[model samples]
Target: MISSYSEYKSYLEQDRIALGVRNDHFSSKIKDFLFPNYIWRFEQTLRKLEYYYNCKNSFWSKPTYYYLKYKFRKISIKLGFSIPINVFGPGLAIVHYGTIVVNTNARIGKNCRIHACTNIGASGGTSHAPQIGDNVYIAPGAKIYGKINVANNCAIGANAVVNKSFEETGILIAGNPAKKIKEIDIKKIIKHI
Candidate 1:
């Protein structure tokens, strides 16, 4: 979990930079921050607010935390994202935000991109959840469960059900019970973005 304001700010910048937005034109940035396809601005704000709430200190006002928390709850209900407080890592990119549920135990890494209708949780009454690595892209309708360790630079294709672990990086996992389709150069794909 993020403990400092600087770290949270860094995550906000990373999330924006991932979407091709630069630190220019304050008006446009504000507009984008207010409205986007995935409402990343709202999600990041909620995450940061929760971080501040957990590590309460003099830096942030109590009233501010309360207000943000209230708004966060409303957004969660409206967006159908039942993400628990402080579970997600920084730079989490929500490609679309509807019917997305991530267990509080799940630990996702930096620059992780998530799509709509995705579920990342546990199964068989096991409390342990998935630990996804950096720069991983989860397509729409993907269901990832169990104590899986998804590697960095990987892609979980649409509607793929990831039941096991895949530590190997830069591979595309697809199908119902997900399997390695092929090794992809995600770095190259990211560059063209």
Candidate 2:
């Protein structure tokens, strides 16, 4: 929860700097207090949109879909920009925004970076959800399902489907059914960062 528009403005500035983007267009102080609420509403609208597009029809009904669709459409008209729902634990980061779904039951650890078009959800209609460890990097279009445990310091490659538990550290997993490809140098990643 961002407390105020000023704080959100500052955060946006910081994010732009972190992303190496020029921040000449934004203001440090927000004159309008309603701006934060508008942004939050926009994010919720985009979340509902992403949920509608990605979720299975069996997972949600027609009435619910139409209701959410109408709600989001209203919010979109009000906010004037589409925002994405961004869930994060302590020290977690999402690089790109849009088409990211994380189950409510899923437990994500600290220092994790997730890209766009990723889905983390439960499998087999079970209550149990994924427990992702620290320092994990989940790439774009990846899906992690079931009550699987992804180990620390691991990288899940683009479009990989992870259905089983992984305990290895500093390894890259890729494929339809994900498997370890090779040992990676975590230090190199830090250097680039």
Candidate 3:
């Protein structure tokens, strides 16, 4: 359970390190703290939150869902301006604190790391969402738009703009219009981690 902003920040830092990003700009202590209940209930409520945040096209019949999600949103807005997507499997690990926008249509996989200033959205009028695979590491300021499929074990470099489909694994993608930089040795990164 995250008790304070510092704890949240620490989690983000650990996630970044695990993703092999050598940086340390995510540290900040929490002062004038409020919302103690959120700290206690975060872990318990996380699963349900992820469900609601992910099922964009589905509607729930239960009243409890609405109440709990409403309360959670209120607390989240008060604590910080984070709108966490209801992603499946452990939720998304935010590596930095900033205005990050993830579209409701976008589908992300488990254990994905999203840095600050990243925008994951759809193209003009297209309902087909971006299907992202597991263990993908997206760098800060990257913009991924359209109904692109990013395969598992891929690293999206900083400020890259990805709008195409990639089927290859263990590659580094970079540039305004992202292209494969080189095939990474996933074993090396795993060993380093």
Q: Estimate each model's TM-score.
A: 0.87, 0.58, 0.65
Write down the lDDT of every candidate, Cα atoms only. 0.80, 0.63, 0.63
17-111, model 1: which lDDT tens digit per residue? 66555558888778767765446656666767866776676655787888888888888888888887776666666766588998989988877
Stretch of 10 with least lDDT, candidate 3: 26-35
Our tally of clashes for model 2 stands at 0
Residue 189 Cα positional deviation in candidate 2, in Å, after optimal superposition: 3.3
Give the poorly placed runs of model 1, Cα more than 4 Å off.
Answer: 26-38, 57-60, 189-193
**Residue range 19-79, candidate 2, lDDT tens digits:** 3333254552253332444434444444444455445265546677677778876764553
RMSD of each: 2.6, 9.7, 8.4
| Highest TM-score scorer | 1
Indicate whether candidate 1 or candidate 3 has the larger lDDT: 1
Alpha-carbon deviation at 150 in model 3, angstroms: 0.4
Span of 10 residues, lowest total lDDT, candidate 1? 184-193
Model 2 vs. true fold: TM? 0.58
